[model samples]
Target: MDENRKIIQVLIAICSLFFIIVGYLTYIQLFRSRDFMANTYNRRQYKIEENTSRGNIYDRNGVLLAYSKLEGEEQERIYPYGALYSQVIGYSSKVYGKSQIEAAYNNELLGIDDLSQVFGMVSGSNYPTRKGNNLYLTIDHKLQALGGELLNGRKGAVVAMDPKTGEILALVSSPNFDPGAKKLEENWQSMVESEDAPFLCRAAQGLYAPGSTFKILITAAAIENGMENEVFEDNGSIIIDEREIRNSESKAYGKIDLKKALALSSNVVYAHLGTELGMGSFMDITNRTGFEKEIPFDIPMSKSRFPYESMDKTDLAEAAIGQGKVLVTPLHMAMITSGVANGGIMMEPVLVKSIAHAEGKSNKELKADKLGRIMESDVAEKIRVMMQEVVASGTGHNAAIKGISVAGKTGTAENELSVKKKAKEHSWFVGFAPAEDPKIAVAVIVEYGGSGSEAAVPIAKRIMSQYLSQ
Candidate 1:
């Protein structure tokens, strides 16, 4: 009996072990198979991938930005523009992981992700993987260079895009690094530790409090909700649930219309508007205007966030003027301005214009897509007039250009942490030129760089003039 019992126990243990093995394999197949297939560290496949060359990358004007070449039977990635377009045309090293455009467009550059196009091969059968498709970006190299120059030496970012078509004209971030440098591997740790964060793509990834730049959205929201012709008395600041929301300079404009209030950037008036709209109505406009939505672009970007937890009247008041947990990327803010400039129709921002394949299957041009409207056409016109007034005779006076009707809003965002320490404010500006034609929309942010008119508007002016001149 004892011998029989021992044999039965051994058989049971073996069955249990077999089930465990099956379960482990199932888990890997269900959850981790795709990652394993795309792992770049597979040394055995490196030689095979080397033979399949990565494609070249170019700007809108057909200038080569990145390309790959053969080096001792190994594929070598090359970036010709150096640090000027570093953040946009990122490095793809076998040793170091990819970031920015390199990683974002990696599949297209490798040609591995083009499975549907596989049947277009010479024999209608994809035997061996072909070279990756070349990419033509929407970036205008000249504008990118000017943007880099304007933001140089300062910790900030600049983004310029076509308001109507959603094509990104120029995107730049200060304190850039050369992707071709051999020392990136050695200095990677220090680079990450640096105060300026040279490796970070500030234009798309860096988040900041928008300040009165948000007033544009607030004013648009007010108009959309039957408050366009509303009047508010501004005494510099207003109180909500005992919390005071004050203007930038703390000066009062006794009685004002929405346009004058926007021109003066009265926080009190905007805060009152927010409360009048209330949290539900305010959040509705926020969602409608592309907040908390995925920004469809060639390169991945951080989305602008509006926290909706623990709602109250004070929170609404603070958020109305772009304070109290409000954060946005420069790219996101540029799109917001673009929406207003393009007559309330927001377009999906595009960077990659086309993909070129040697298989005679050149990809189609990127079509402009609507990302939902932010306001009525008439409302956009009213806001445009107000923004024009801002540049004409208000806080954005310095933004005005000769023979050009510039529509813009200036913002001075106070740092939350530094409010107690009385630190410098971040300067901000969102503008579009030739107000009637509206060619380009720009967003500029200067870190701890005084007021928007002095620091940020000049940068926007130069960028707008450069594009409009062209």
Candidate 2:
């Protein structure tokens, strides 16, 4: 009887251990992480993932971006374009885990989401499901390549989207790492240690002060609130709430209208407008434009912030010109520009265009959805004219594409908080092309880069030229 009791106790312990492990796996699969690609907790799971199949990823034109292959008993992932789409398409690897689209839509690629496929596997299937499915993104390969090339070795990000359709044409971040390269672990470690942060999707995650590029928002607010005809003179600088704010370099025009103020990016005029408009009006306009909110997107996106509460008179003035607690991502700026191009309606930005099953089934297409109308059409038209002047004859002249009629804004964002303050300031440019019938809206940011024209506009020019020409 004692021996039998011991046997029973051992059996209970084994069952308890099994249940605990199963519970942990269920939690990870259903809640913590999706798909088995990232879970490396057990050797058996690792072996299964190593041998399992994954979907192929392609650009809008069906150019292969990523695909999987079976090498003996192990599975290998291939990125044909190397670092071009490194951050956008992401990599599916057993060692480094997953990110962006790879992890976001893992189940779709694994065919687990399809009930028919699961039943086939359960009901004694003879044929194997090695190739799961295919995902086609909205990104254009040539445009994406142009973006990566334009970034060059600079530490910055570039984002381009279709103003009408809200399709992301190109997304690129510099200081990237090749996931398919040999010694990926070593390379990833180096990227992790780099100051530029190659792993960061700068277009969506890197937040920075918007600088003069923020003047566009202020201009929109002014126009929408019946201040389009309000004229103010720029005597180099103005005093607001006991704090003096000057124009860029303190060289201001003696007299100017609202259009001229925005064209010249007159800080004094904008700071004064901020004080006049007040926080109540500012919040209403900004909130409508989707500020301080989680922008719904196919992949993860960081929130664009507008710190309105607890702001004093001086803080309000500073925030108007895209400085002093006004932080935004490149993606957020692109969307704002897109909103202006789409006549005040902000559409939900989408990356994945369609998904195709390996069983030759019908393709699932994702349609565009309108987020909201953030501004009045008349107000957007007025600001559009002002932004056009900026590109045609003002600070953003460098962004002018030959015969394209571009409307853009330049920003030399001050980087005062960085430990290496003298390294350089963040340069920014946001704009749309073919202003008469807007098609593309873009935002460029070069960290520690010089003036907006010199650092960011050239990149914008090249990207727009490539996309529009095509």
If scored against the real structure, what TM-score would every candidate get? Answer: 0.86, 0.87
* Best by the lDDT measure: 1
- lDDT string for model 1 (291-335, tens) is 787787777788889978666888888888888888999998999
lDDT of 2 by residue, 1-470 (tens): 99999999999999999999999978965775443433435343343343346778888898989887766655677888887777787777677777778777766676544343224233223223445678989999998888888888788899999999999999998877786735466687777788868778888888999999888888887886788897788899888867888886799797788888888889988998888888987788779878889887877788888876767779988998888888999988999899888898889899999999875464799868998998888888888888999988899988888789999999988886443666767899999999878889999999888778889999888888888888
RMSD of every prediction: 5.5, 5.9
Clashing pairs in 1: none
Q: Could you say which candidate leads in TM-score?
A: 2
Model 2 lDDT at residue 72:
65
Return the lDDT, model 2, position 186: 60
